[model samples]
Target: MDASASPAAAAPDPASTPGPGPVPPPAPVSRLRRLAVPVGAMAAAVAAFGYVAAVDPNEPGHYPVCPMLRFTGLLCPGCGGLRSAHAFAHGDLATALGSNALAVVGYVVLAVVWLLWTVRASRGRPLRIGVAPVYWWGIGAVLLVFSVVRNLPFGSALAP
Candidate 1:
């Protein structure tokens, strides 16, 4: 401590210290912008289903045969999916279910999933599908059973 060293002389100037000034608030996001992903997904689905409805899958040569059904004479889980979609698009629920019950169930599941996605997106939140392993196994089991049943003699009604 020197005799001439005063407390004010040792202090640094506050103006020289770097500090962050007032930060501007974040720009507000619009509702439509928040729902962009969901809207795009819905548009894509509508376009695909619209095309499937326009072109008849029941008519041979309109659409390619399922590779699994072509190679093996067995009905896969997605054997009559296009026919199901065609019937569904035409508002014929019975025919859609008859064409492919599993595909009809899938359509319902997809709709529910899409609704969930849209709702979350509208609320500015991301949709997170965190299915447990058990659920995945259950889905696999359903597909396996559907494929097997549609191919068996007792499951003639399930066949397309």
Candidate 2:
């Protein structure tokens, strides 16, 4: 060492030097931040369902009439969905099915999907949903058939 060199003037430690590998940058958000959107959406949906449950649509004037049915005097597939939800909320399965069988099925599907969504969100995984075009067309076809059937005299029992 030089006579004038002090302890602070020594060669830099190899451990303190930059390494050969590229450094990974810090994440823009923590794990909790990534979960916020999904959690919020789930909460909103639950609140909406709670509101629908609390406001029973079975009472004739509680909810607005379905415009399509009012104008056409024909039952659309969704004609009695609100009532169905009301029935479902009250634990009246028969009334729910009577009001709207499709709505009951939709409720079940929504519940299942929501459960999966919550699980995926908690696990910090991206949600994935892919409804093929054919499936969408099939849904449309089913709705069309339901509308037609509900309006026919033979299917009067299915009418809302």
Candidate 3:
């Protein structure tokens, strides 16, 4: 050590130290407040399904034609989604699948995700979907395949 270096210089300054002040605790979260989002979302979905159930999508001009089906003469992945939802809302699983299996699957998935979200929120924990990039790519690939297959002669059953 250098002789010029002083021990006082190495010492921590008391003036710079933080005081023992009382810090207030965070406000307690209410259960209703935590559950509000999930409940509202569920209500919105139920209302939408109820609307679709009341309206007949199978009837011509009741709903807008699929843009891809109109322009390209090709069945898009979501071509029969509305019809599927209508059938599903009416408790006709067979017709729902016949209209659009993917949409039916989507409805089921959404319900499951919503249920999970509700459960987590009730416990004051935030739910996260950390799906890998590969999973997203796989989903895209499935949609592309469904679109292509539903338009083919062999896949006429999948058509809307």
Q: Which candidate is the best by lDDT?
A: 3
Candidate 1: the clashing residue pairs are none
Candidates in order, TM-scores: namely: 0.83, 0.76, 0.87
Best-to-worst order by lDDT is 3, 1, 2
Write one digit per residue (lDDT tens) for candidate 1, span 38-121: 889889989989999999999999999988889999999998899999999999999999999989998898999999998988
Q: After superposition, how far is residue 140 of candidate 3 from its true place, in Å?
A: 0.2
Cα lDDT listed for each candidate: 0.91, 0.83, 0.93
Candidate 2 global TM-score: 0.76
Clash counts for all predictions: 0, 0, 0
lDDT of 2 by residue, 1-160 (tens): 6844877657777778888866789766666877788778778877877888998776777788888878988888998888888788779899889999999999899878877876787676777999999999999999999989988999887876
lDDT at 15, model 1: 80
Per-residue lDDT of 1-160 in model 3, one digit per residue for the tens? Answer: 7744878877778878788767789898999999999999999999999998999998898888988899999999998999999999989999999999999999999999999999999999999999999999999999999999999999999998
Best by the TM-score measure: 3
lDDT against true structure, model 2: 0.83
Candidate 2: deviation at residue 81, Å? 0.5
Model 1 score (lDDT)? 0.91
- TM-score of candidate 1 against the unseen true structure: 0.83
